[model samples]
Target: MEPRFLLLSDVAAELNVSDSQVYHMVRSGELPAIKIGGRGQWRVERARLEEYIAAKYAETAAWVAKNPLVDREDEA
Candidate 1:
């Protein structure tokens, strides 16, 4: 690992969300971040970003599993 870190804009672009959403995530503690200075600059660790993406995927999978479509058929 190269100790990668992402700026707020990069994270917002990666997540396809607004900058404010990223700010909210940081404030709400949904996403881990660090302040660089007194200018409210925030950075997210690459590892943490990956973890959050994985967790979101898992959550979506669980939701889909619990709410299967009525017309869907199991191929097995």
Candidate 2:
């Protein structure tokens, strides 16, 4: 079975990003995460990570719609 929560490194690996980037996202509140244990290490719920990915997809779609790519051929 899949784990219910993931470490920052695991999340980063899944997203193909750096662990520090994931930490920053959690710190900035751009991504949802929870601190556990006495050391307060961060953990992201699998469902929340999925939600974040879906939200980014929608955000990117909106941005692409607003800023349609210009064909380089048309620039000449």
Candidate 3:
């Protein structure tokens, strides 16, 4: 498969997040990226992005499961 690359604006639109957020992710090494000249570029493999999202979702789910409300009825 051809490697797909997206500009900061396009990535922000697709993620429904601000451009800065994507930039931060790249800066913090949370998201994979490549540097081209003076610009930091992000090139995400579609499968890798999907895996990251899935891992994040699972982490959130695990946290919720571990921190269940004290009052079970109140949770309902």
Candidate 4:
């Protein structure tokens, strides 16, 4: 069965970033995570991670809307 929650390292591995960077993102609230268990380990819900990625795409689209690219040929 697939797991619904991922460990910090698992999230980092999936995102292709260092574990510390993932930790920083979670600390800054850019990503959501929960610290549970007797060791206070962090767990990131898969659904929330998907939401965060979709939000980033929406944000990038909004940015592009405000800064349209111009064709270089028109500058001649």
For candidate 2, the TM-score is 0.95
Compared with the true structure, what per-residue lDDT tens digits does model 3 show for residues 15-75?
A: 8999899888877977766666555456655555566678879999999999975997877
| Model 3 pairs in collision | none
Q: Kindly list the per-residue Cα lDDT of model 4 for residues 1-76, writing each as its tens digit.
A: 7699998898899889999999999999889999999999899999998898899899999999999998999888
TM-score of each: 0.82, 0.95, 0.67, 0.85
By lDDT, who's the top model here? Answer: 2
For model 4, the stretches where C-alpha displacement exceeds 4 angstroms are: none
lDDT of 4: 0.92
The reply for model 3, stretches above 4 Å from the true place, is 1-3, 37-40, 69-76
- Greater TM-score among 1 and 2 belongs to 2
Candidates ranked by lDDT: 2, 4, 1, 3
Per-residue CA lDDT of model 2 for 1-76, tens digit only, reads: 9999999999999999999999999999999999999999999999999999999999999999999999999999
Which model, 1 or 2, shows the larger lDDT?
2
- Candidate 2 residues lying further than 4 Å off, grouped into runs, are none
